[model samples]
Each structure stands twice: as structure tokens, then as C-alpha cells.
Target: MTRTKLLAKIRQVFPGHDPEDVQRVLDEYAGPERLRVHLAILKLCDEDRRDSPRHYVDSACQDHRDVLAWAESPQQLRPDWFSLSVTERAKVAKADRQQYARWLAR
Candidate 1:
């Protein structure tokens, strides 16, 4: 999404707050994670059609929930994935891949 659209969505999600400050926090803390979380929220809220197939949107929603569960769990030894830098997010994604592989093997 464009910066303006993202800022507007952030404002809508967090009303009565400064949009500039919200943008700064999102840029610094959430980064790409913002898109996943926001998309999941939008899908669940369903104020508009997301222009994606229902299955694709459902998968995104599930992935977002998994990320949230991981972030909230003590097993997530590193920083919260949402707050991590791009490099850190990559590392976490790698670890998650391995974990999923192991789960599948069981």
C-alpha cells in the first residue's frame, strides 16, 4: 500500500492518536509485520473485499494468528517478530521453517 493509505489505515485502527506518531511507530517497530497484522485485521473485520481469493485471505489470517501466538509465547527466545529488524525477521522465519519441518516429520 502507499504511505498515505497505510497512514490512513493506521489512523483508523487507532483513532484519537496522532497519525504522524502512529506512522513513526509503525515504521520503526512493525515494519512489514504491520502489513500482515493489518491485513488479517482487515480480513476479519471485512469492511471491504480484499481482492484476493478467499483461500489466500484465509491463509494469511491463519499465518498472522500463528505469528501472534509465537510472539506471545515464552518459546520465542528472541525479540518479538513484529518488532525485529529485517535481518532478525529473516532469522526468525528460518527458525520457523525448521520448526514446521520437524512438526511435519512427527
Candidate 2:
């Protein structure tokens, strides 16, 4: 459950996706759950608003509430969230949680 392993898993899950923004999340985090929440949240946020094939939240957020709520859900997910080690956390989060659900379907 180290950061390196977690990052590798993330890359596997999102082969072509950029890690820069996700890296931002990792830098702020002390451990794996933070990484889990970030990837889960990022996937959720990106999926909710897919104007393109890429997986990033709109750089220009005309609608912020959806992403905010999506962010909030992770707080509730912490108990189950904490159980996951840095390694399994992302796999669990990415598979179970469909992040983009919070956003408005355009």
C-alpha cells in the first residue's frame, strides 16, 4: 500500500489518462485512502461531464455543485474507505463508485 504501488494501479486503470491532476491530489495526501478518494473522485467528476474522450473535469467549471457533491461523498465512504490499503483502495473505489454520477448529463 505504498504511494508507488497505488500510482501504478491508477495508471493501469486509466491507461491513457493524465496523472498530473491526480498527482496534485497525491501530493496533498498522507496515504492511500487519499489516493483512492482522489482517483475515485476524479473518475467520477470526469465521467459526469464528458464533452470529450479525455478524463478530466472541465477546466472551465460552469457547474461546480455536482463535482462538490461528488467530493463530499468520499467523507461518507471513509469507514469502508479506511479498510482499503493503499494498494486495494483504488481498485475498490474505481470499480464500485461511478464518479460522474453527480454531474449534470449534458
Candidate 3:
């Protein structure tokens, strides 16, 4: 399935989940470790309590934050960013970049 459809499904599963938080969870949880459990919980949440994380952006995700921060820093961007999901990575990229910059400076 496409990222858009996946994100939409996730949103439906957790209406209160911050979109950025969903993205972060997606990035981090796409692993063999918690993959099954997370997906199951997500499904269970859909059936029972569909709750989403509040702060989705990874403060320590320098790479992801860097991508976004650089994009809007000099107001430059990679063409690939446009090709990616407009809502998730791109939006967080902007915020993460800003937040990341400060976090890194210290």
C-alpha cells in the first residue's frame, strides 16, 4: 500500500494521534522487534481504544530532522522531498529541523 493510504488508515485508527507522532512511530517501529506487537496494538486500539502519541517527532532523530531543517533553512529542498508524502515527513521535516537545530546547538 502507498504511504498516503497507510497514513490515512493510521489516522483513522487513532484520530487523536498527532500526525507527526504517527510518523515518528512509523519510522521507529518498522522493525522486527516491535513490529508485530505494535501493529497488533494499533489494530487492538482501533477495535478498543484508538489513542495516538502526542509528540511524534524524534528529538534525537538528527538525520530526519536535518533533512527537514535544511529544506526550509535556506529555503532549499530536495526534489525527493516533494515526491514523498506531503503531510508526514515534509511537515515534520520543517518542525523537526527547527526543533533539531536548537537541540543540536546545545
Candidate 4:
């Protein structure tokens, strides 16, 4: 998504948060080969931990292993999971498969 649309989505998902902080979190966490911003936010929401996007982004960046493990098992699977685009879902699913393959290879 474009920066403008991303900003709008973040504002919609995390109302009352400072836009500056949201942008910073986006810049730090969201990337093509890294965390998908929408996925992170959806995961956070599924875990009922939507305190702020910054908190999620910080933990995801600094303690990615734990964050990824958390993503593997949400407290409850939310319908919002369907909100992800087909490409995003496929990418994450493929990543999961690769991760599991590596784990199995170990």
C-alpha cells in the first residue's frame, strides 16, 4: 500500500494515536522482506494487545523471535485475518512453510 493509504489504515486501526509515532513505527517495522504492517497490526489485535502500534513494532523488531512465535498462535483467530490481501497471505504462508522446513532440517 502507498504511504498515504497505510497512514489512513493505521489511523483507522489505532485511533487517537499520534500520526508521527505511527509513521515512525511504519518506517521501522513495515517492509517488503520483513514485517507487513497490516499483518502485525492484525496479529496484535488478535492477541488483544492493541495498546499501540509502536509497542508491537518495537517488540517485533527487537525481539522478533518471540514476536514470530506469538504470531504462530494467537489467543483467538480473528475474522480480520481475511482482510489481508491474497498476495500477503500467500507470502506469509510461504514464509511459515520455509521456517518450518528450516526447523525440521535442524
TM-score of each: 0.31, 0.29, 0.36, 0.44
- lDDT of each candidate versus the true structure: 0.47, 0.47, 0.46, 0.56
Q: Can you tell me which runs of candidate 4 are displaced by over 4 Å?
A: 30-35, 42-49, 63-106
Which residue pairs in candidate 1 have backbone atoms (N, alpha carbon, C) closer than 3 angstroms, thus clashing? none
Residue 51 displacement in candidate 2 (angstroms): 9.6
Write down the lDDT that model 3 would get.
0.46
Q: Candidate 3, residues 1-69: lDDT per residue as tens digits? A: 355645665676777767567766756644332332233334434444536422222322323333233
Off by over 4 Å in 2: 17-21, 25-33, 45-106
TM-score of model 4 vs. true structure: 0.44
lDDT of 4: 0.56
Q: Give me the displacement of residue 55 in model 3, in angstroms.
A: 16
As a TM-score, model 3 comes out at 0.36
lDDT of 3 at 79: 58
Best by lDDT: 4
Clash pairs of candidate 2?
44-99, 44-100, 48-100
Top model number, TM-score: 4
